[model samples]
Target: MDSFDSGGVRIAYIDVPAVGGSGDPVLLIHGFASNHAVNWVNTLWVRTLSQAGYRTVALDNRGHGESEKLYDPEAYGSEDMAGDAVGLLDHLGIGRADVMGYSMGGRIAAHIALDHPTRVRSALIGGLGMHLVEGRGLPAGIAEALEAPAGTPAPNPTAAAFRTFAEQTRSDLRALAACMRGSRQTLSRAEIAQIVVPVLVSVGTLDTVAGDGPGLAALMPNARALDLAGRDHSTAVGAKQHRDGVLAFLAARP
Candidate 1:
């Protein structure tokens, strides 16, 4: 594990060489409240991408993992988080590379692709979709649950859901609440339409959190969707079909 300071906050990350990978390097970004380990390495993504010939790079998106923690909502913004990813690339002297992200990370990936196209070769966006248009903010009270004093019950299902996930991952609940409040930036259709990099929008068929995957793909100039049949947002991450789609898409891109 390695880390670097971006602005005043320290961010944790890992960069592993693909022993025999012949494909373009891949930068892996994990989801909200989840670090590189729980979201990527433990899920076999690092090994999978590396074995397939991709030098894998991943990071804990500021408030998660061993990175610096900021509990104030103003301290974490989706654009700032996206900037963290770009900053990591800059720190490593990487001109550009393929970028892949899931869920909240997917939103950050979209920002990177749309706002920092020259720094991204292509994007593999999973667990996110047309909801990028329908809505982008965390459901009301979700953040509240994270910030609530320990032992206080969450006020809503949305809050409970995230609160439980945070507990499961042993995340800093306060930092996650701040993240939710600040990381809600979204791309308008016009913005997405301008992204030139080929994109693979994959989501579980049952993922309500992501909305319509195919619909989101239709909005992009160069994009496609991969359906993980019966998978939901949580289960889709480990689905073999998702892995196959990524490999096939990456292999087919120029």
Candidate 2:
């Protein structure tokens, strides 16, 4: 993995070239409590894209993975995180590229498409949907779960899941707590509508975390949704259907 400085924070990332040669670059953003390896590499997204002839660049959001962690809640806003992603493209001298993100990463990708339209050729939003506009983000209890004393049982199912996942990933509890609290900002309908770049909103049919995929996609002029049949939030990212949909979407995109 390589590293770069983004707005004073050191972000860790892996830049893999397409199998044959230079190919269209694609920036990958992982979800909350997940790093580039867990969400992308372990899921075979890097290999899939690379073999499909797309350059893949995946980053660890500030508080997650090998990147420097900040305890300040103000330091983890989606916009700030989005800046880190764009900075990577600038660092690589990429003028524009397709952006793909899941869950929290999906929100960050949307911010990139909205705030830096010129830098995004397309946007693939997975594991997130209408919630990006309607909901605040992960439940507040998730932050508390991350901050709970060691050995304390999580208060609820969602919290327990997050707590366990964070622990499994060996994340910085304090940094993840702040990130959960700070990065919950949701985009407005008008803001979603402003994103003109071609967008694919993919979500599992059984996912309760992400709202309605088609409903969210309908807000944009050039967006559509792909339903991952019978998949849930946790299983959706790595589903073969997801891989196929994304590959097809990427192939068909302008």
Candidate 3:
């Protein structure tokens, strides 16, 4: 584990080397409430990318994992999160890199691409879409579930994952909820079109969180879509189909 000061916040990260030799740097950003280890390393994402000759860096976002947690909802806004990624790059002396993110991380990646376009070479967004800004596309009961008490026990595997993620990150449920509400105000479908980098939008066929992958792909000028058949949100991360699709997309890019 390594730490860097990203705008006064201590950002935690892990850099994994490619198997054979160094390649274009790829930064992996985890979803909301998930740390670098849980979201990427534990899912074998580092190894998967390294095996394909890509150096990988996975960072724990502010308010999650070993990174500094600022309970202020204002600090957790998308702009701040995007700055953290750019900060990491500046600290590491990386001028540009490919970025891949899942869930909330995907949203942050979009901000990075749109706001800090020069720092991003390409983007891979998983488990999210522009529709989230609109209020009607999420899973049937997700909003209700998120609004439930922070300490409430989960009833199933999916819920269990969320609960565990929230607890592990020591996230302030109230602040996170506020941040979610605040994000809707800043997100825009028209802004998504401004990101000109090659993008790969992927989601499981059964993913409820992202709403629709094809819909998201259509919003980006240079984006491709992939569906991980038979897998849900959680299962798609390390699944063979998901990895193959992402790798194929990356390989096809110049």
Candidate 4:
């Protein structure tokens, strides 16, 4: 576990090289309000990928985990966070690697695929889908809820739940609030159509936050979509089928 300076921000990350066997390296970018451990490691992605013979790298985005807290909304856009991913690779001297991002991480991954396609060999986007084309994922009140007093009741239950989840994760409330606003950058249909890297978009069949995985995948030039049966956004992360799909996708490519 170590930290690197990304545009003056201290971004924390964990880089585990290949062991037992050797294969292509994969970079794992976590979802919003999530750290590397909770999003990837805790869910056995690191273990699975390592045992499957791939080097793994994961990072805590700017406002989450042990990374520097930036309360400025402008400091937390999808592209800026994407830069942090590239910064981690630069720090590790990695030229290009396969990438997988979940939820908010999915958006950042898309940004990287669009802006720095050469840096990514392939990408797997999960916990997201047509929402990337339609509208913002989270509600507007989530930021306000994060800024609310710890015990204050929120009119929006979804917002309150997120605030509670953030507190449970020991996140900086203000910074998370700023992140909510800043990371709302979504890809338009035209932007989605422009991504050239091979991609796999997986989503829970019941996930409301991520709409129409198949539709979104159809829009991308080189992408496929998979549906996890009986899963939702939070539950889809730990799904066995999702892992298989990712590994299969990577194997299907170079």
Candidate closest to the true structure, highest TM-score: 2
Q: How well does model 3 score by local distance difference test?
A: 0.78
For residues 67-112, write the lDDT of model 3, one tens digit per residue: 8766556787888888898899898888999999998888788889
Candidate 2 has an lDDT of 0.94
Q: Summarize candidate 1's per-residue lDDT along 1-254 as a digit string, tens digits.
A: 79998987898999888866455678888998888998898888888898888888999998899889998777777788988999999988889899999998999999999889999999999999987767743568888888788778988776788888899899998888888888877788898899889999999988878888999999999999999999998899878898888999989987
Q: Output the better candidate (1/3) by lDDT.
A: 1
Instruction: Estimate the TM-score of every prediction.
Output: 0.96, 0.98, 0.87, 0.97
The global C-alpha lDDT for each of the candidates, from Candidate 1 onward, is 0.88, 0.94, 0.78, 0.90
Inter-residue clash pairs, candidate 4: none
TM-score of 3: 0.87
Q: At residue 94, give the lDDT of candidate 2.
A: 92
In candidate 4, how many Å is residue 53 off? 0.5
True-vs-predicted CA distance for residue 250, candidate 3, Å: 1.2
lDDT of 2 by residue, 38-143 (tens): 9999999999999999999999999999999999999999999999999999999999999999999999999999999999999999999899999843555888
- Candidate 2 residue runs with Cα over 4 Å from true position: none
Better of 2 and 3 by TM-score: 2
- Consecutive 10-residue window with the lowest summed lDDT within model 4: 15-24
Ten residues in a row with the worst lDDT in model 3?
Answer: 135-144
